[model samples]
Target: MGYINIDFTAGCTNNKWENLLHTHSIIQLVNTPTRITSTSSTIIDHVYTNHPENIVETVVPKIAFSDRYAKCITRKINQKDMPCLCHKQIRYRCFKNFDENNFLGDLNKTSFTQIEQIIDVQSATAMWYQLFLSVINNHAPIKMKRIKHVRQPDWLTDEVKEAQKKEKCLPKQRELE
Candidate 1:
């Protein structure tokens, strides 16, 4: 056969595209794949068109939302020993915001993280959509409460002391056995 050209999205001079309603409906909030609890194959129903099939599989780009994009997922894996293959089986049908390739610098914002089923956070793309990812041991939760110090008044100093004594007596009563 002779050389043939294809009008792929990448060929477009302006990087622009429209999100289809079908893709939007399948995903969960934020337009991510909602397959974990999906009773049907709606999540992975291969979308096919009459366009000529392109055997070539192009590489997809990555995007990060949070500033901690690089370290989004710190997965422990070893080649010698078989590591967890959970990430491999979890596939999401979220749409990419950037060009045909991938979005860059929107860490953990994909719909895949919002799935009801257990989704792996180790995938490279998952790191890019960190906003949807659940917090694990790797993340340090910010303390929600603050500590307060009680001040004593000169006139009520005796009352405060009496309360302390009563509290101490109650504890002693428990140990009195």
Candidate 2:
């Protein structure tokens, strides 16, 4: 579990954020004093890492295109444990096809004599839960669903593609201008 701290807002004087630096063993990476705001001269933007020894160094690029200074961190990790982990996706029924009449019939078949004879509160609760699950399993059994990915439509015209391209590029174009 690797932890990274990226603070973009003005957090230098904020007591809540400053407390984290003291409580946790995180090391600050951005060192240059000029990385702070020019007008306020406050070190707001920061990047911290728990594994400071693993990191080679941090660099603040020249603010040529944007006001915020982006910090770049380089870390060396053990390659033996670098393989990505994949977990099997689990899918369960959302109970959209639950039959009320079938569920009522199954619940009616449950023996009530055992529950009536229960003296302890915990035992009664457990018996009720077990009976409920048994009824539900018989009437509305859960089904595993398989995921299906839908491909994009190939009927899109050249004009629509051009419009979509323009829409994506509009933000960057506005920022540059």
Model 1 Cα shift for residue 150 (angstroms): 12
Error of 2 at 61 (Å): 16
Task: Note the Cα lDDT for every prediction shown.
Answer: 0.31, 0.62
Candidate 1: residue 35 lDDT (0-100): 22
- Looking at candidate 2, what is the lDDT of residue 25? 75
* Residue runs of model 1 more than 4 Å from their true location after superposition: 1-151
Q: How do the predictions measure up, each by TM-score?
A: 0.14, 0.37
**Candidate 1 structure quality by residue, lDDT tens digits, 58-155:** 21223335221111212343566765443332222333332332232223334553434535433333333344333321233322332243343576
Error of 2 at 78 (Å): 10
